[model samples]
Target: MGVDIGGTKILAAVVTPQGEILAREKRATVAEEGPEAVISRLIGAIEAALSLAGTEPARLAAIGIAVAGMALPGEGVVAFSPNLRGWRDVPLRDIVARQLGVSTFLINDASAAALGEHCYGAGRGVNNLVYVTVGTGIGGGVIIDGKLYCGACGVAGEVGHMTIDVDGPRCNCGNFGCLEALASGTAVAREAKRHVAEGAETCLPQLVGGELEMITAETVFQAAQKGDPLALEIIAQAASYLGIGLANLVNLFNPELIIVGGGLAHMGNMLLSPALRVIRERAFEVPAQAVRLVTAQLGGSSGVLGAVAFALQQEAEVRP
Candidate 1:
């Protein structure tokens, strides 16, 4: 069983060792109701998935949880989560383990995705891989020599917070000019709204029926596809920032592959092509040439599939 606990939703799945999802269930997180409520929802999601698969809790060997936060696996606690309101120091693994009567393990969501990619997705057979998820925020997962590197505190793969500009716009993390602040989905939407507010000529306002708050990164992509100059400019700027951030990763990690995933990846070549061009021009010549940049193969299933991988790995480590 694999559960992905996000801020707004909890997704649980019964997965086979071969990465096939036998059954799945999703539920609203209702995080604002506090940890206990959210945990209840998570448990319900798991049970629903199990019922759908026609399997009992006793038949499950183990459960893995992918949390969108800094999870201390050793402590069985979620240290902090920006997305889940009021979430701090919650004993997630123990709670789930006790309720389901099965061994449960916790993993960082991005790290889980990284492992999923490394084991079965685009980075399969690659020893060194970097997985960057570009969505509302940017998150990264690193596999070094076929091992996930969680750093000393298990919060290592936070590439989004990297400072790209010293005097640029402030990020929600209280930093100035983070890669996330410049290139993420949130950034794209913010930039578009800012430009439109400043009297930029574009059809976005009309598309959203003059609701500025309704502008989203997807909106920008859609407009750009139609040759809307303002939308095209916003995308170009965001892609340039993303390219620079990716170049830095290439120079630093020199991984065999970099898998770009998350919602923005749906933009296809409009996003990857420009980022690749920038990487070739800016990153170290040898490493950049040696590295292959590709889109994620798993898409939305990466998180749940990754949870299963972590569970299997944990079971393997304890067996011997």
Candidate 2:
């Protein structure tokens, strides 16, 4: 079984080698209820998925969890997390291992998604790949020589947090001018609200009735699709920043492919077209030609499937 424990939701699923989802379920994290409550919700999700899959206890091999924060092996503690509150020194792996008597592997969500795509999705045949996600925040994962690269301190491929501008907006992670703070879904929503408050005539402003509360990323995307020039500008700027970020990744890693995922990627070619243009225009020739940037193929299942695959790989290594 595999679990994706994010700030707002928990997704549990039984996945197969062929990327098939046998069964799955999800629930909100409800962090306001505290750490124990979040753990209970995670446990409920696992049991529900197991029941839905009709898998006997003996047949279940292992469990993998994709978490949102920084993690270290053997400790099972989330050292730092901007989204999940009161999660310091939390023994996550130990809790799951003791409660279920199953070997549990923990991986960050972005890294897991990269592994999943490399193993079964767009980067299956590629020796090197980077999966970048633009959503509530920006995130990325790196795969080198067909292996996930956690780097020193298990924090590699954190391209989103990389400083893009010295005087840019502040990020939730306390960084200034990160690509995420500039171009994330949340960032776009904020920009929409700012334009509305500034009396910019936009469908986004009218759709939210001049209130910033209901202006979400989805709404902005819809407005852009309907030819709202302001909304289109916002998305283009985001894609431009995303493109620059990718170009930097290309220059640094020289990967064979780059897979974009998350809600923004759902904009499809509309967003990718501008991003590709910016990347080609900015990136060096050799790295640019070697890279093929594409959308994520597995859709939303990448995290859970990647978690399962990570566990399976660990088990495979232990046997011989």
True-structure lDDT of candidate 1:
0.90
lDDT per residue for candidate 2 within 46-132, as digits (tens), equals 999989999844577888888888765446666656667788778888898889888888888888889899888889989899999
The clash numbers for all candidates, in the given order, read 0, 0
lDDT of 1 by residue, 105-172 (tens): 99988889998888889988899989999999999899999988889877788999999999989897
Give, for candidate 2, the lowest lDDT window spanning 10 residues.
71-80
Instruction: List the pairs of residues colliding in candidate 2.
Output: none
**Candidate lDDT values, in order:** 0.90, 0.86
In angstroms, the error of model 1 at 209 is: 0.7
Question: Per-prediction TM-score, please?
Answer: 0.98, 0.96
